[model samples]
Target: MGTDMGKKESLLFCLDRFLDPWFGYQLPYQDAIVDLLQVVIVSDNTLSVKEAALQLICDYAWPPFPVLEENFERVEAELRPDVSYAMHMDKEIETDS
Candidate 1:
């Protein structure tokens, strides 16, 4: 499990490097950008990292692709459990009272 986690982190690092150059520049190909983001999101081992990368794509990537938007929605859905747990902790505490 540790080895797998290490590999996932390494892959994410490489992807970050690949994305760095394109951050400020205009994307030349829509398909390539979408494909790259898909790879990043799918390769992510943790929900937090996947959510962060998806948010980055939504915030930074230009000429918004529908496929990317769809991917974001899907990732967001996957993240709902974490979000709900974090946001509803107070409600749980109140219920226990």
Candidate 2:
């Protein structure tokens, strides 16, 4: 599982970097960014990484395009792959360790 942990950590780091506040910056590669986040959301990573990706989508990429909103349910499903959404906790759960 070491490789999984490493991959998870790398994805989280990328998300955290994307979470930073940007001022007056133009996104020439917005599609690429969205694609990366989508991949992370569907990957076998932990809930935290997927949640971070979703957060980035909602916060940074959603308002202008709005199409990303369509996959919110799918991204959320990663939080609780086996259980119902209502049965899950409100806080981010780290299952990689």
Candidate 3:
């Protein structure tokens, strides 16, 4: 993974590194990512969109990053912790208010 890779390559490689072992963490795709987003979007106690974005960068984001940090900041700013935090989505309501 250290072969003068371009930004995109590096990002993909880094993601591969994560995704490979991430499975062992029992993070099934639909049950994991989508679930997290749902909880993060609904709960009042979760990270703010900005905070989530920062966390994504700090915890999950890869280097040679193509995205600007603030852009992510803006996106995560709207995340609902409840929606993303749920183990199951049978109880979530889309509060599109």
Which candidate comes out best when scored by TM-score? 2
Clashes of each: 0, 0, 21
Runs of candidate 3 exceeding 4 Å displacement: 1-47, 69-97
Q: Is candidate 1 or candidate 3 better by TM-score?
A: 1
The lDDT of each candidate is: 0.51, 0.54, 0.36
In angstroms, the error of model 3 at 5 is 36
Please give the distance, in angstroms, between residue 65's alpha carbon in candidate 3 and its true position after superposition: 1.6
For residue 65, what is the lDDT in candidate 3? 30
What is the model-wide C-alpha lDDT for candidate 1? 0.51
Q: Of models 2 and 3, which has the larger TM-score?
A: 2
TM-score of each: 0.40, 0.49, 0.25
- Residue 4 lDDT in candidate 2: 75
Tens digits of per-residue lDDT, candidate 2, 2-97, equal 347667657656655555556544567767777676666655667776676666665555333222334445545445442233223222243433
Off by over 4 Å in 2: 1-22, 63-97
Which residue segments of model 1 deviate by more than 4 Å?
A: 1-5, 22-34, 39-45, 55-60, 71-73, 77-97
Error of 1 at 77 (Å): 4.3
